[model samples]
Target: MSKAHLPTPPDFLIKEFASFQPKDRQAIAIKVAKLERKVFPAIEHFNYDVELKKKNIGMVLAFKEDDTDTVVAYLVYQRMKRLVWLHKLCVLEQEREKGLGKRLIEFLRTQMEKGGCQIHLWVDSNRKPAMALYKSCGFQQIEYRPDYYGPGRAALKMELSIGE
Candidate 1:
């Protein structure tokens, strides 16, 4: 998809993941891990430590309730050289279709632009919603691999350039 086709997200609050409160972090982790298990059971899960140690890892989180700070969405990416690799993006099942995912992508794009980075991500071809989301966020499918996850499962490699 072209950059002009992407939809602009509505107003939303996104904050760098700095709340070290164990409970808060654990809560977000649990939700993300659970969703990952449900959506991609065959994939290896990323523990908090492993995720945080990636080169230039940046985590942005979105809250459902302003007063309570309950995490409902998150985007995790790692910057290496001039490229930003999107590691994970998750939104609570109940909160889908509310544009939280797009908001997370926008936040990531803003950060990457500041550093003149291009974005890369891989998604299962069968995951229509995720594929659509990435395409709508200006990622072009650059490659396709059959059986990427396993037999009968294909993956699409997508890329988005934020700057030269």
Candidate 2:
């Protein structure tokens, strides 16, 4: 059977946390926390303090649905020297398979390439969809840690070279 193609996303607004008020950032963080709880109950959620700091360089992609502003997705990464470590990329459950995650990764890649940084990320070995997404985005698996998260759990470390 042929796989169904995901539709192109509508034009959504992307903003960094610095553009939002402290309360707004907190709201986004809460949403992120809830998503993590639902999606990866075995993993530890990101601390709000660290996530807020990472948001300064990351982005929140959102839109209005039924007259209510909603954060459909967000990217959290940290820049260190010539490397960009992708800490988290979350898309609302209903928004999955619609290309928002890929768009967010591509957006970050373009921005990081301008600064000559390579992007790196790690995904749970069990998450086949996420592994495929990273691979589709040009990330190659560089390492595998059998117990990166804990016993019986593993992680795949992947990297994408943005520039020389």
Candidate 3:
């Protein structure tokens, strides 16, 4: 499909990826696995314990209309102290560059404001596109590590103080 064919998320659509459920075990696992493959390919396996904890945490999943709804994007986060740590943000290949990421981040900031936390996330150093997107959204890189993502993959810790 052409770039213009990318779907715009609906204004009436809700912004939340209700945490995975035991009954949804298979579906959630498949979705999460696909996400990890495309986004965290270097990681051999996901941390199940941490993922289980994420079930109780807040999240957002953006869906676009099709014959049946399809998840176009998603965000996973948790609060630590006064910081809102975004653990994951994924937008399908077809959905990228359509401004869905911007809307998702803005929604996260609003969620942080209501919860009284500042938003932050750990980004891979080489992900220039993600860094640019975060920068455009007012996120500043506050820290960096030479090999934070294991082996040669480095990381940039970014923060966005909300409701200030």
How many pairs of residues collide in each model?
A: 0, 0, 1
Preferred candidate (TM-score higher): 1 or 2: 2
List residue ranges in candidate 3 displaced over 4 A.
Answer: 1-14, 19-29, 42-56
Candidate 3 TM-score over all chains jointly: 0.76
Candidate 2, residue 25: lDDT: 71
Give the candidates in order of TM-score, highest first: 2, 1, 3
Candidate 1 residue-wise lDDT, 1-164, digit = tens: 33222333443456666434655666666666666666546555777656764548877777644433466677888879898889788887877888888888987787667657789998889989999999889999999999998899899999999966
Model 2: residues >4 Å from true position, as ranges? 1-8, 21-23, 54-57, 64-68
TM-score of 1: 0.80
Encode model 2's per-residue lDDT on 1-164: one tens digit a residue. 11111123665555555557777777777766666777655546777656567534555454434423577777778878798889888777887887878877877776666657788888989888889999999999999999887887799999999866
Could you tell me every candidate's TM-score relative to the true structure? 0.80, 0.80, 0.76
Candidate 1 deviant stretches above 4 angstroms? 1-12, 19-39, 67-69
For candidate 3, the per-residue lDDT at 31 reads: 65
Q: Poorest 10 consecutive residues of model 3 by lDDT? A: 1-10
